[model samples]
Target: MDDITEINTKENRQLLYKYLIKMYGKEKAKELMFKHKDNLFGNNSLAYSLGKRSIVFYCLYFLQDYFVPKDDNTVRDLAPVHYDIWRELEDIFIHHTHDKQQFILPRGCAKTSIIDMALSCWLHCYRESIYTVVLANRELDAINFVEQTKIALQTPYIKNTFGELVQPRKRTVNKLELELDNDTKIQAYSSGSSVRGTSYTSSKGKNRVTCFIADDYISEADILSDESKEKKYIKWQKEVEEAGDDPVYRNGKLIKSGTKFIVLGTPLAKGDFIDSIKNDPEYKVFHKSVVPFDPDEYFENHTYWQKFKEIFFDNKRENPLQDAKEYYEANKEYMAFETIWEKYSHFELAKKYFNKKLVFMQELMCDVDNVGDSWFKSNRTMPMKEIENHTFIKTMLTIDTAGVKNKDAKRSDYFAFVVGSLADNDFKYVRQAHLRKFKEFDEYIKHVISLLKENEDITHVYIEKNTYNGLDVDAIKSEMVKHSELMKRDITFINEMQRKNKDDKISTIVDAVNNGRIIFCEERVEQSFLDQVMSFAGQRFSLHDDAADCLSEFANRIDEIEIMKNITTIPRGWLF
Candidate 1:
């Protein structure tokens, strides 16, 4: 449906029935409006600007005729999806001490258009904020936010209601700052930059920044590691956040109200910036995922939806929804999961990243971690106590080095090691130990030797020589000489040239687990190792594969795995 632009419509439909009833009596008007609702619109008026009760109505009314430039900048109406959130936010902003609030919404949920520009206008229009500050990741973003606010002030409805917020002669609209005629200053700055001078001396008195808005302050590209995330966290906390104090003024014996702090962004990962705010008890958060309910729960047939989706997006067809019109009318409930916006339903949006489950989960669902089918059955693995009585014929260790040339690099991948032994004639492999860490040459070899010494039955060791060009293995071999006095003599160290595809090789571990041949010692296994093995799906599917790859390497050599338990064992490390 075309956007309901005429405020007459927003104003009319709300009271059209009452007006019609006054003219044609209650029964007739009710019959016409209910049975033929499409023909009716609300009663026309600008009465929503009266008071706090009109907060929701006023914002929803202003959603149309936005002058802000966001592609095809024409009058657009707020979708039904916007009402609930806006109502809730308007209530909080108008009548509560929302000291720190967050709106962690999905990527294209119109958060900026609604909250940053429109809701901000609401605050300024109502004189809720004295000095408002917008903080962003980049200088351009900061400028853009402030620019949009200025543009909103220029809109017809805004001007008619608020009456020229900016002063004509004053430095009203600069690149990053605007001083309204009401002595209200709204400015923008890049996050982490110095905001020590945000305090302004207005004619009335001293003006401390009473509002802080962090909007898209942290993007996906900003978060690389926990350390990088912490850097941003510190900047946000120190500069952008601390710039605004609670009270705008202090009387001799009384106090004023506090700042209304707001944050808006989608979370990138489990321990990212948004999650940090969520964990803090002081901040109030409202999170809205793109898909409200699991689409597959209601719509079980993928092939059917794929057909309708294909037809809809073909564009070549005269009508996109024509082919599946009946089907959609019947099954739209599956897609109607109370999305934040009705323009894109759950099924409609899912097609954008249908194959990329991890991306879909992170971006659309706000899921810190994606949960899906794993290659191995994590529940089937036996604990350490269950396998204590088993006799071991051969033991070995496999290493998956997080490829790095510099051992001393501050940020490098971990070296993951897996130690497992084959028991008697049964194909079962019992894990003895697992370790993963960022270690230098000496420390790495020390752990390797400890794994060897801890599990004395280990007769063979294999380490994938990735990027290190066998240098890591060679370093360990050279370092083993130092520990030769403490180590047993028969252990053989082999530099494994990892020419095979890791994704293909990991299948062996899955097969071993499915056959009940691979067992995990819960007490001895490292948590990271367990996480890797359980979460790994294959190729680019998981974040880390160190521990899983080490076990997969062990499975690769399973066929000829043998080590002379008493003698130079024949059934030792197996050959793949």
Candidate 2:
């Protein structure tokens, strides 16, 4: 026997058991090393047996040899996130439960390597008498997945470890199918292919498709065009859903219950096929973005960050590449704390990093509104250079409260408020805005009072009466009375009750923004406000429209406020 085989013998196993007992307690060590004795030490060596337990460990040790050589002849390290996802999928597959899973990772996060290669190898080696179907947007992609799986299976590590268990009956890349010795099969099919009518059958007369994995079902090009998106959605509903639900038969007899469907893709658009499945109650969505740290906290706390962002945008307009380099070099202190800068400090990291602002927000942060079809363009909104220079005729505050009073409710809408000053030219400059799910009514009241106290010029406060029977408005007024000593100044509270539909509210805000009537104060404004405005896609489609709704409430009243100002300014004789 070989040296490795000799080490895995009965004598060596007993010696290792004694060593493990010394290290860990006898019961703990026995549970760890000898729980699956037959599977671990029956035919395969200890290295193969232990490695096979974890997909991440197996890939790192065994599959590293099979990785396609880089330009420098070095293999890339698998990211930590990949390991996390592999373990999650491993648990699901082992339980044999019909559960739907979705992974929303960024591009180049190795969704293909982890799913098509590592997971496939693990499944083929461990699980037997099961069939898996791989689907993609195009036939070529599906074929590629199968090709990669075959390569992974052919690797010396996999061949040596599970040699007898999963011998290949048929392996053809072009055919997009593989048959194993244990009567298990894997097939690849395109999204629009004829998969609904077809059934995968094993040598044991089992004709059940156990697992279905759909990867990159929606392409970037498909998301941009409306017609293509519609067509893809139709194709997904008809073909993809049908194939996932198709019955599994054995020897002309119905055998399996249901297939476990796993959908993996980056969120390229809002209402894509992946998104459709995400909304479905059957699927459990595990959406993860590449955000290294929370940008919201920084943007909210740092006064100069918003101004810095405005400068970055201005510089990007002229030359995105050169300007980013210059900005990074000039503001090294400011950029040093950012996660992107910590990893990629150089300018030539990639051309895409030059457009870091959009890439970071869209790709890493997974800001669906910024990446997909947005109603309001983020670039169109200009920042104020000097708030002091602008002359204000009237200043107003608009508040939109979530109807629910429960502090612990997870799905409760945010309490959003916008403070703006209407200039002499009727152009309303947004001084500041706040949007947050308040924990209590006291907290919400405190924030509102703070905003009013900070901006002494705020003459009118309009609270949208969309809550339970004007109780929220009455509560606010009652709270304001308690803080009258602190308020020190008279502030008129207006209960605006004429509720406009979501479409009208969005349209009103869009018109004001596009027509150059609503200007945002860059220094004082919150990033959440911009995100809400940019992501607002009318009432039905948006994730959160509270911020936009608050802004629109102010916009709708701008004309009325202007007219009231004009009437007050007119002479008494002229009025007579």
Candidate 3:
């Protein structure tokens, strides 16, 4: 009986060894063989425990693979970059999801893809019916993003999960609506299109809103002007932001996703949401650059990653172009690659491309410094501290029209006009500030007329002949002519010739500001304007500070109260 039992035990051991050999291979199986050498080895041993764990792991992995399709485009299982952004958004989803926060990212980075996938997953997988509104600066951008998202969903892997569950359809050219099985639907709308007035009614329409994404609401050039474009941008931001109100929690999240609005573009030359965020104390902004830190390891691990860095040379200081070349030579790979070091390179780029001071405040760092060799300082631009409460008269207005770029939405300073006094140093609170950004040109014309009516103390109006491709100047004159027929007041629209250098004019104005001759409105005007004013580089104005430019030109063109020389010269000291 003992011999028969021994033979049966040997047979069982042989079968187990064969299975182990097949699973773990010969070498690993040999290691396991010793683990099971003891009579009690099967109960407790390193190899025995590892064998058990491996089996359990494989079983779980197999189950997950079977249930979850290989192409699950869900946010949770997105690519690494998408996953990182999703993680940032996940916190927002649970807490501040309803609050409108602007998101700015560069182009061609699959931002729309991630957003659409996230929305779809949030809706179908989580079974949450969300009222999501996706807006773009133009109808084309909005349509393209939505269509791409729909196509992504149609991928074989994505279809396997929620294909029959939710049907993605393009109800219109500018509208993409998806119907879910649970009677929950998502409707997409474009800000540039007529969808602004579209009804937001729902079955349970008790203030229903889940997400709002405004992608590339403004281009770089549009945001830098002091015309209607700036105004339109501000207005759209306010209206779209207010659209996401939820009576339930009274908390709705609004996201502005675009490269220009956030970062990855030239520093704003005019006032923008980015400027507002930097200036507003109540709004705590969390800005994270794409590659905020050294991607040495990441780049080393994945060499295909390409980075674009811009370097600048200050010709005023050293040979700027030469300095840049040498700098590039010393740090060739790092210079060409986007990394933590590239941010420093961006500072150089800002200095050379735009103005050093502008980039410093708007890009490299958030600290707004007034000290620099700027057009304002060189031109003796004055501060309100010196000119405040001075008796003066005869206010004139100058308009910088931007009608061409502002065709999509009128949220830009396309028509930036400054109303100030030429004789009276006492300018009435910087009133004639008009930013045009509405669907209709008539709205802008009316706004400008209203400004004119309010500031009745004005004697003359000067419009830049080339403002808005010169056509706008003509349009304004035509509009004024039409208004003359209706109103008894005689307001003449005169065009200014661009014979002199605007930079020299700007430089002269800068000298005035620095000499404490020209004063700015403390309450109404933003420090961003001042920062922009003081940071005006000698020539390449970049595109953000048009209002400041208008203010500078208006300030410079008007004769000073008195020629006060030698106020404060930059003390000469060290030459290293």
Candidate 4:
């Protein structure tokens, strides 16, 4: 269900039609009904038909029933953002401005249903463009848009206002394509599908594929790799833009504004297709996040946000989401955040997705700094002030080993290791961490032994039972045995197999970091380790997850190792 479009419908529409008949004669009454419909909102079809603003009038009058609500309590009205997009679309179809445009929208704003779907129907009804093509990342999504357009054309007001636009007998109406009565063909295609021969010949003239509406064309596959990203740009150049008549300019004036490429989507990735268009000079861009104000200023030192997160994310509370909604609705003005659309524009709705802040930012705010899902937040990991004199019951080293698979490969996974200790309280402290290439095994071992000496009470060394199994453990033992200083303490070596599901194994770290159970000493931990740990966008999307893997192993095994030691439950290393 959608938020009903808030319109001025205080006056009865059917009763007003009757009044129009009484004021004027029957013929003029019908004319006045067409002219002054739905309180008019200062619009009438008689005056609207003469000018280029037919799109707006049609939407206000014909699509009124579709948007306006029956409930008087629903305060969701059409805001300025809606009219701004309507005028921009009018500029494209009627006024002939820059043909290419992109609308970067917050997710819940209904401007898209007007700009992309309903406007396409108006274009077909007015016979504006001969051949129109709509596209999405998937063909089914494009078909969904086509379905909306088809439904709009058949609406009661639309059919009553403008007679049957669908072809009388031989209408080619289906899921993928629609042929209007005026011989205007509108087809839908997936992003990379063929739209080469998109042209139509009418009695007036032959027009190439002129109106191209691309709505949410960037998919996960499009932004997967560099080659796929390039292919998206190439598709726009060859299929959408190049397939139409090239716009001709004579004297700094656009003589022919050829094709319209309007993209409607929220930014998913940093340099995806919509972002690339935003940087280009030839196209016009309209970007609106959830609110019109600067996000930084609104969220800086936000007082109510923490309480909101606690209440919304609480699983024990019954109807926590509804209770959270009521709380926000009462105190929203005190927060003083203004959404573009009043209620439906994702104002306090971030509480619903507080756990996925990156998604909330990228989807609702169009801030693609961090693309999407983040398992571990870098800021959540606290840093200790000092760690020199702090004594630990037991310190263990976890090494994420990567064998030298191919020396000639452009890039190789790093051998990441983390040294962690269990304190007297239920807190695990990261003593040190570093990463290096697998080629320098000697250097890697030297660093490991050095860390061992630094953390002298190192009880055990654990390695994943993979590549560096048998001789590698022995080599480390030999190096430690050579040092007379390390001869006092006895160390255990274990080559253990890890769980196959990496994300499932690493799931505990999220709560551990968020709840302050784990701390990282910034002085000892390398920046590379922190970066890999934070940028691990779940399910192995990062270039190298060795550092994250090492941290996960270290965190999971801390309690088990303390149990093996049978350490006193009184102080540090009490199975933190």
Tens-digit lDDT track for model 3 on 79-186?
344445544454454334324444434333445544444444443333333455566656677667666545443443223323343453522222466545434445
Residue-wise lDDT of candidate 1 within 116-224, one digit each (tens)?
8877777776667778888887899888888888877765555544557765477567888878876788888886567775785667778878888888788655565
Per-residue C-alpha lDDT of model 2 across residues 482-559, encoded as one tens digit per residue: 876545666677885755555445554664464344777777778877787878875556777888888887877755
lDDT (0-100) at residue 337 of candidate 1?
Answer: 49
Error of 2 at 160 (Å): 1.2
Query: Taking the tens digit of each residue's C-alpha lDDT, what string does model 4 give over 363-457?
Result: 77887755435667643334455554455666898888877655755467778888898865446788888887755567767877887888777
> Where is model 1 more than 4 Å wrong at Cα?
1-53, 67-77, 167-169, 247-255, 295-338, 345-347, 369-576
What is the TM-score of candidate 2? 0.52
Best by lDDT: 4
Question: Ten residues in a row with the worst lDDT in model 4?
Answer: 1-10
lDDT of 4 at 515: 35
The lDDT-based order of candidates, best leading, equals 4, 1, 2, 3
On TM-score, the leading prediction is 4
lDDT of each: 0.65, 0.64, 0.45, 0.70
Arranged by TM-score, best first:
4, 1, 2, 3
Give candidates' CA RMSD values in order: 14.6, 17.7, 19.8, 9.9
Better of 2 and 4 by lDDT: 4
